[model samples]
Target: MNYELICGLETHVELSTKTKIFCSCSTEFGGEPNTHCCPICIGLPGTLPKLNKAVVEYAVMAGLATNCEISPVSKMDRKNYVYPDLPKAYQISQYDMPLCKSGWVGLSNGRRIRLNRIHIEEDAGKLVHDRGNTFVDYNRGGVPLIEIVTEPDLRSIEEVQEYVEKLQMILRYIGVSDCKMQEGSLRCDVNVSVRPVGQEEFGTRAEIKNMNSLAYMAKAIAYEFDRQVDLIQSGEEVVQETRRFDEGSGCTEGMRGKEDADDYRYFREPDLVAILVSDEMRKSIQKQMPEDPQKRLTRFVSDFDLPEADARLLIEHRRIADYFETAAKGAKNPRAVANCILGQMFARLGTEAEKEQFEVAVTPEQLHELILLLDSGKIRMNLVKSTLEKMLDTGKPAKEFLSEQDLAGMSADDLKAVCEKAVAENEAAAADYLAGKEKALKAILGSVMKATRGRANPQEAEKLLADIIRR
Candidate 1:
């Protein structure tokens, strides 16, 4: 019997707030191991926790962006668990009273992945395992996080990847989280199961914990699906448990038996009061929501006439999208601007860090000027590329690079002279062209562009070359 895979995700996103969720300690990524921790974050005696207002505001913004229903009244609860990373012995999280619920993120294929809830919580510390030794770092402890839980609506690996990417784009666009997988700012726990093709009930599910990379997540899910199927074929029961993906072996090893909701012994936090989000507060946060990435992508395709692929690339990063719009504004050809930005400009920037630090290198005006020059036939396309490189390297404008490199297109007199030289040099080819060897004209045009050092306009020079050789 054919088996169908069913998967859901629990994505944990670290907020970009200035301080930790319940403490004033720094939430910066890399620091001395335990230095960022304080009495409250480290769970020292008699220290009380306070909620960061910015955390709530950011959570509400995320809810609004994802079409979630913001909970007017929510509260935190204690999840009791013992681990090396969690210092509090009991984690303060939202069990039943989550901040956002019943949301959905739309995919490019027009499928909607329904969200169960987006709850606020604190991040646990990191565990460093060396040779026969283990260490815990509390730097990330008490860092604000929003756990986005999705319903089991995904059936394929492609849908899961697309849903995660779309959700990341929305979160990043709303300025809630950076969603950097490498930095552990964004991580996912995938719950996967396989059932018969026509089965309504799901098979025994395995939860893969803390998958930080999307590529690795796909691999883990694929392997786990096969593992479950193999077990069933062999007549062994598929046990429900927590598993950790082994990157080296490209498989998953069982971690422990999966715990149900009652296993955590959840209860309301006695130290903190319930969070009351008023209607006015929700409206205020909603007012600050930016244009959704998908909406902007649609507008770009319809209004700006950008191809869907180009539009998707632009809207992947909010800053890059904003830069494209600013440069395309009032330009002769917005498509040209989009192409240059996506093709040439992004090629030069190279890395994400360089792209983030890119505002100083090329301005919107400079890009617009480059497009204008190309459109007006003032510079050849080759010169335009070199000009962009020079602009990036020296942080200069396109005009400066064009003028400094003497890259101006050859004048009509200069071009005609070069074409004549090319014809004189390739007399046999010129004669062949006159003799109706039409392909000979292309050879002559190459030589003219070479003689002019690629400054000769190909269209104008071809006209001149054809006219010269035909006469």
Candidate 2:
């Protein structure tokens, strides 16, 4: 606790372009081993590489959404590295002049995590390890990616989570990438260090690479922080190296020595020309960009009069927010629609994947029709809820389950008649209510609901029954 945690993150988001960054090969996920690759992807001689225009556009949209400055001129650089997954032995990436720079992702705690840069690069392939031999899949090789690097601004585990989640939300909202960690669409490399509370100098950092889960990432950073602090207090130095998070042990194991930027031997790529972003191009991308998540959150709260918490839950995914807007377009009470989504509909969506997809049996239009019935007073909330369950079960309209008599609704006189009948049958309950047994009123209310087949409004029936009992 005496040491302060200092952390920075490097997030790699694979753009959903149809083709690779510098090759025409398919970037589709889950292809057969090496089937999607061409001669250019494997670094064959005399195979010229061309940049994908969509990759540039997608990168620009991401930059604009994150409040980054788009560079007018940028160039690709070959980062020399040798790995089995990287068949090219060198990666085509941006180094000196990245596509986006100086951006900040804001945390809910009001702290802005300063972004160092966001650069486009080609992704490496996958390595499948068997008993002893390792097989390589070049299908993912040359897939276009954008690396978002942030300065050492994160100070706590909570901040680290908020930062990553917000980035994922923004990337998915803008349609550049899905940011699914399970599918390797998004991954992070965290640099963690510690210093004494009163010291300004940072301790040596250990970089934890390819942490896909936010929970594991937080644990790794916490363990690494304590590890560094212990080392410093014991008169030992923390080593700067790359590490992998051991999920079973909840600790980070050192992989290799961390390389500085110079280790990559970055040089201007002769195969590709410089990237130019004119005002016209930037404006075009801006028009294609969707609304910011923060702005949308503000609009949802102010326009729908939703509680901030409810609004947040609604906007956590883009599809859910869109579904809400469609269902609550002109409803009298938008909160009811929010309830049906966060409550009844969410119950059926068992997993986070289902919530993200939001594929429900009931359509938004169908839900709006149901809410309209409640708005018109044709059905009470209790009936609405029950009918919604049926509607969800059968994927049918409210009328499919609602009888004509039920939809007609119980008139005031009809409700009073039901109330009187219930009081006549339950004489003991009526007497107990007058005798100051408040709990007995619920029994009488239950009788009325049963007699009317749950058609009578509880509020009206209870009030009418209470008045009749006093007389």
TM-score, per-candidate, Cα-based: 0.92, 0.96
The clash number for model 2 is 0
lDDT of 2 at 420: 88
Q: lDDT tens digits, residues 1-471, model 2?
A: 499999999999999998999888888888789999889998888888899999999999989988899999999999998889887789999989999999999998799999989999999989999999999989999999999999999999899899999999999888899898889899999999998889888888888999998888888888998788889889999988888999999988988654542388889999999999998999999998878988999999999999999998998889999999999989987999999999999999998888989998899999899999899888877788898999889899888988898779778888888888889999998899999998898998998888877878787777888889998
Q: Please give, for residues 287-360, the per-residue lDDT of candidate 1 as tens digits.
A: 88888887899998988888899998888888888988888877667898887788877877777767655564
**Highest TM-score scorer:** 2
Each model's C-alpha lDDT? 0.88, 0.90
Give the lowest summed-lDDT range of ten residues in model 2.
254-263
Clashing pairs in 1: none
